[model samples]
Target: MKYAVFTGATGGLGTLCVKELSRLANWMVFAGGTKEAELEKLGKLPNIIPVRLDVTKQESVNATLEIIKSYTNKLDAIVNFAGMTSFTSLIEGESVEAIEKLLNVNVVGTARVNRTFFDMLYQGHGRIINCSSESGWMTPQPFAGPYVLSKYAVDAYNDSLRRELIYLGIPVIKIQPGSYETNITQQVYENFDKTISNTKYYKKLLTKMKPLMMMELNQKNDSRRLVKTVIHAMESRHPKLKYRVGTGKLLAMLELLPEGGVDVVYKLIFGKQGHL
Candidate 1:
């Protein structure tokens, strides 16, 4: 039987992906990071196997490996949905520790998870889907520097991995989702508030960015299409190298602008405070 693994399986988008993938009768889904309570709530859905996996921890990775080995030796696909987000401003001299933490989870941790299952993926001629954000390509939003930096790294890592594994028939796919319904915005806002309270600088700029952040959060697109896009990437015989889901024409066009052009646009949008 075809088998797959999805890291960050308990997240908002991850949960949707898992539920939809479980409907595929021919495939087994190893829902990474799921808890016992979640499994019970799922009520023994066919082909959905909940496993306690955390990409950041070696022991958790090892346990997931053992669990997968007990069921199937090959993985047809591995979707990396695990990620970290933070609201940080470079001008504020954001915490080095926070930036490192995001990179470790969003970049290094993802690399480790894929490397652990590399052999199985090669044997199965599997595909890898990494869930990146629109921030991966677009200009960085104010006070969201750390999360944007991590996603930029994710984009580069996906490109390098795809090229590296090409000879082995293991395809790497990137799914860049635009604002979608998730708790990330809340977390980032909370972080921003905490940082502002603790810091002496960027207070006015941070305050200015608050309404914009709230507007962005309110604009979250339904993630159903993103889930379908991921499933297609997994099942398609010849999937595209990158899938940009939910990014509207405006944002899409903005991505084509030169860095200077984008910078101008940002300045216009948020006035002098928008300089990246």
Candidate 2:
């Protein structure tokens, strides 16, 4: 039996992926941070079951895996999309909590998902879809340092995991999304003022980054950006190991370029002094 499981199903790309997964898999599990009401509503569908699985909690992850195991020894695909954590440019010591939370949820959470679900993939001979970010390649805006770090770490680990899984004949795929229309930016906005107001080092540029974050806050993701990749990763006979969506070929080329070249390009764009 083919099954699909999704985390972060409450909102953003996760919610959209859950909707799509419902169409493809015989059974679907929706794991969320704290959106039980919505999950219950989604779970009401004949094939969909909403399970509370906070990626940050070991027991929650274990219980969710047990539910999947009970359904079948095999899972077609698992979307590790459980994260609401972000970082503001300012390191207000207060940001430490969020920083830790972001890493714990995104990096450690992904590892936990991979570990718990690999057995099902081995059984069904399927794939693991990890939602990486353009941030995994580069940090564009300020005050989002921790998010960039965590994503970068996840990207690296996924690459390694993908390689290891080849021996098991289960593929691990990565989706690198550009700024999509999602609730993530709202979190950035909510923390924008407090994060900057609490810091003194980057005050001169605070007003500058305001518009950037505000612009980002009001933005919404093209659900298609994520949907298309999720489908390709699941359905295609030869799904790509990495999917880089949106923003045309230029950015794709940029991500492909070596890191030193990328740094030179960044310096050129920002006109910053060379340090290396």
Candidate 3:
């Protein structure tokens, strides 16, 4: 039998992946999340073991490791999806505490879980799948600095981790997905609202940015594509290092420009008075 653990199991993509994984024969899934009610629901599913995990806390990650160890000595796969997003101006609107919290959840949290479960994964020669975002590689936009910074860190962290783990015959895979229909959009909007309320200078800019942000969020693709890519990474004989699903061509094209050129583009978009 194969054993897998999925963090962020209560989330849209996480839940979809867990349900699909549960349908596979001889597979046991540990659905880890912070939501008690959602965990209870997942626990009712066959082959699903709901584990309460708050990846931002070391103790919580350690406790989850202990819980999983009780059931199996080894884990065939560990998929990390526990992440948070922020939509605020880094210099003027967002608090340092808020930025720190975002980093803790999206970057440190992922590392903590992987570190806590390393021994078990090593024992099984398993793979580590990290859910990064298209924002990780694309040229970042204004007001999304915290989230973009966190994802870029994830990308770098995963690259380094993969290089180290390759010697042990454990492949570390990264899934860089584009905007998808997920609860994260709601959280992003909430953060945006809070930023608007708190900002003294970026109010006008943020006001103009709102509709553009809305359009981007509304253009999200079905999240099932991401789930399918994740499953492919888990089950394939030789999975690629990175799987990019539904990435945006325009953002990607922007990434190819020189630093100065990109700066000019942003300046034109936001204008001298910060009106789009």
Alpha carbon lDDT of each predicted model: 0.82, 0.73, 0.88
TM-score of each: 0.90, 0.84, 0.95
Per-residue lDDT for 1-276 in model 1, tens only? 899988988777888888998888988999887466765644377789888888989889888989899998898999999887887666555567778899998998899999998888877888899988888988766667788899999999999999998978788999998876676756877887887787565666567767766666667587888988999999999999999887745557777888788878867765663333
TM-score winner: 3
Q: Tell me, by lDDT, which candidate is best.
A: 3
Candidate 2 lDDT = 0.73
Q: For residue 2, give model 1's deviation from the true position in Å.
A: 1.1
Worst 10 residues of 3 by lDDT: 267-276
Off by over 4 Å in 1: 34-36, 39-43, 91-94, 248-257, 265-276
Q: Residues 176-227, candidate 2: write the lDDT tens digits.
A: 8766666775676667666667665655456655664565444454777678
Off by over 4 Å in 3: 274-276
The 10-residue segment of model 1 with minimum total lDDT is 267-276
RMSD of 1: 2.7
| Each candidate: RMSD | 2.7, 3.9, 2.0
Clashes found in each candidate (C-alpha, N, C closer than 3 A): 0, 5, 0
